[model samples]
Target chain A: MTYCVGLRMKRGLVFMSDTRTNAGVDNISTFRKMHTWCVPGERLVTLMTAGNLATTQAVISVLEERSKAQGERNPSILEQPSMFQVARLVGETLREVISERSTQGQAADSAFGATIIVGGQIDPGPPRLFLIYPEGNFIEASEDTPFFQIGETKYGRPMLLRGFSEDLTFPDAIKLLLVSFDSTLKANLSVGMPFDLQTYVADSFEIGHEDRITRDNPYYNEISEGWGRALREALGQLPPYDMG
Target chain B: MTYCVGLRMKRGLVFMSDTRTNAGVDNISTFRKMHTWCVPGERLVTLMTAGNLATTQAVISVLEERSKAQGERNPSILEQPSMFQVARLVGETLREVISERSTQGQAADSAFGATIIVGGQIDPGPPRLFLIYPEGNFIEASEDTPFFQIGETKYGRPMLLRGFSEDLTFPDAIKLLLVSFDSTLKANLSVGMPFDLQTYVADSFEIGHEDRITRDNPYYNEISEGWGRALREALGQLPPYDMG
Candidate 1:
């Protein structure tokens, strides 16, 4: 289990994911959920996945394999003209891996379910984000829905409900996400850190602003303590319920 | 789909549920998810359910029927001596109904996956909360884990994380729940409006302050707006991500 969020805002695209995975309670391990594919000045794509690690790894392996194939028309994400096409290629790969594994009787359902949040710019259009399903279908982000989440998404919905907006600054987005993630982490053990976060400033097809946010990350610690205090203060501020 | 939460706090107990039932996106209707059995100052038990509507309705109907039966040796919720016994009765009722319906083979295993949050006091004992699973087994809430959520639980976890505390006032608990429910409503269309909320003070067993909270409720409106503003303010307070 994991928690990952992709935001497509006016300034750029933001992708964040936790680095925790578990086969069961005893086999818990920290595995980064975010992966990047960049072509320097031409394109920069970030993919974050949730579900069975083997299945997601297989999907990514296939994409990397097809991309390096000698003049093959396998429709690698690097060669896709648009984010939509990239999503299609990712979905197709997910479907392919799932079908192959299911043939060997793995019961490829939610235990083996895989979904990806794909976000980046393709040189021609503005930054975009997509949530590609296990079935090889997907939905793109819109002004009405500026963010997409996968894995342990519900634990963080309340904060996103009121925090996400098209006009949000990249910093505000990251902070809102931190508070959201803190809330999720307290309630659910599946989504832990260190977090993998990357911000793409629309036309800046560079990949330097990536950070491996650990528990000791200074700003993160501030937000966690501040948000907890603020919440208790807020609760104290509300008018008491009078049942008389 | 449904959303229900039960809290066990020093102040007392709070139980709330949304009344929306849906088979799919198209088939949706309003049906109360709360059931109450009271004996003035003797025993007061409240049960809130989530999962297959048919299965829940069946369990409730059986409980209601058993409550009205006279001189029957078969144990039922109303006849139970302790709140723990009441939870056991609800679980047994749920398991019975599920076994009966499952024999018909109309639905899958998730159909029997109905969950109930049972809480209240029986005469001398303090107020307590228990979460009963479909198998008729249940777990009691403690100081370390003072709440239980069912149905569409994920979207509300963060809000509860931020807002919930053993020290919170009952009114604050209600407010926290509204924000949590609001988050859930915004994220999942399956859980919807006209919620049912009931709060019971420790010794004030006879007076169950249950209300049919609709979209027009003033306090509800305040919670939704206040939460939105509070989130924005909190996010605005975070330091901007220094992409230096």
Candidate 2:
């Protein structure tokens, strides 16, 4: 299990993902799930993956190998003309990897499936966000859906639904994501720290602040503990359930 | 699908269950999932179920019939010697119904499976809570595990973990449950109002406050709307995230 969120904000795109992956409870390992591609001022593509680790790794490796060879025959996600095309490339790559794995007859098709959140800018186009399914289909984030979360999402979702807004500042958005992750971490052992985070300011065609938030990260610790106290206080603020 | 929680506090036990039941999104109906069998001054037992509605209903019907008959061989849950025995009776009945359904060759064995949370006090014994699994096995809630939630549980669990405490008053416990259920209701269409609530005060051997909280219930509306506001305010109370 994993937890990753790609949030589309008014000013930019924010992405966060947990590094922990497990085949089973006893067999757990830390693996970075966020992959980034950039052509400096030309394009920036960020993807956070959740689901089968093998399939995600294969997709990323394919994209990386293609990007290394500069040709139209095997275009990299970095070479895509727009964010939409970039998303399509990622989805197709993911589906291809899963299809190859399932064709090997080692496991069921669903066992090799993965989901992805892809977001970035391609020159003139605005910063866009998309959730790419294992079936090679995708949906873009819009006014109604401003964020996409994959894997172990439910525990962390209520906070996002209540707190996220279009005009949120980068720092505030990070804070919100940390709070959401904190809720998920507390509830599920499968999703653990340290979390990978990235921010991309719209139209900059460049990545913004990037950090690896570990358990010892002072800000995360503060938010985790402070949120609990704040929640109790918040509960107190509600009118008492008067049996009268 | 359903959402039911049985919370154990210092005062007694608090149980709440959503009334919504659906075979599919297109075929939805409301049915009570919380049932109580109390021998007033002798014992008070409450059972809240989640999973296959048919299996749960059949188990309840069998128990109802047995309780109506007076015999040693046909022992009813009400005739149980202790709260533990009552849980055993519920578990056996659940397994029996599921087994019968599967043997009829109608569907898979798991399709008829259901889980239950049963708690109460029988004379000379303290209040006890048990989570009965489909396989006729059960585990009691103790100091470490003070609550049990069945079906569509993840979205609402964080609140219970953060808010529940042994010393919590009945009103506060009910408030905490309402908040938890509100989160689930907001996140899932399978679980909806009106919610049924019942509280049993430990030695009284009688059910305490019982109420059916409807959508238009002022208190629920207040908590639902207030909780969102309170959560946002709580998030604001945290120190600002500084990228410095």
Q: Write the per-residue lDDT of candidate 1 for residues A1-244, one digit (tens) a residue.
A: 8899998888898888999999777789998788899988989989999998998989888888845656753437888998878888898899888778877774644556799999998888778899999888899999778899898887777778677887888778888888878878887888899999898888988674788889999888999888877765655555555544
Candidate 1 ranges beyond 4 A from true positions: A66-75, A104-111, A237-244, B66-75, B104-110
lDDT of 2 by residue, A20-75 (tens): 99987999999999988888889899999999998898898888875465654343
What residue runs in model 2 are displaced by over 4 Å at the alpha carbon? A66-75, A108-110, B66-75, B108-110
Native contacts recovered, each model:
0.57, 0.81
Please give, as one word, the docking class of candidate 1: medium
Which pairs clash (backbone N, Cα, C closer than 3 Å) in model 1?
A154-B154
Candidate number achieving the greatest DockQ relative to the actual structure:
2
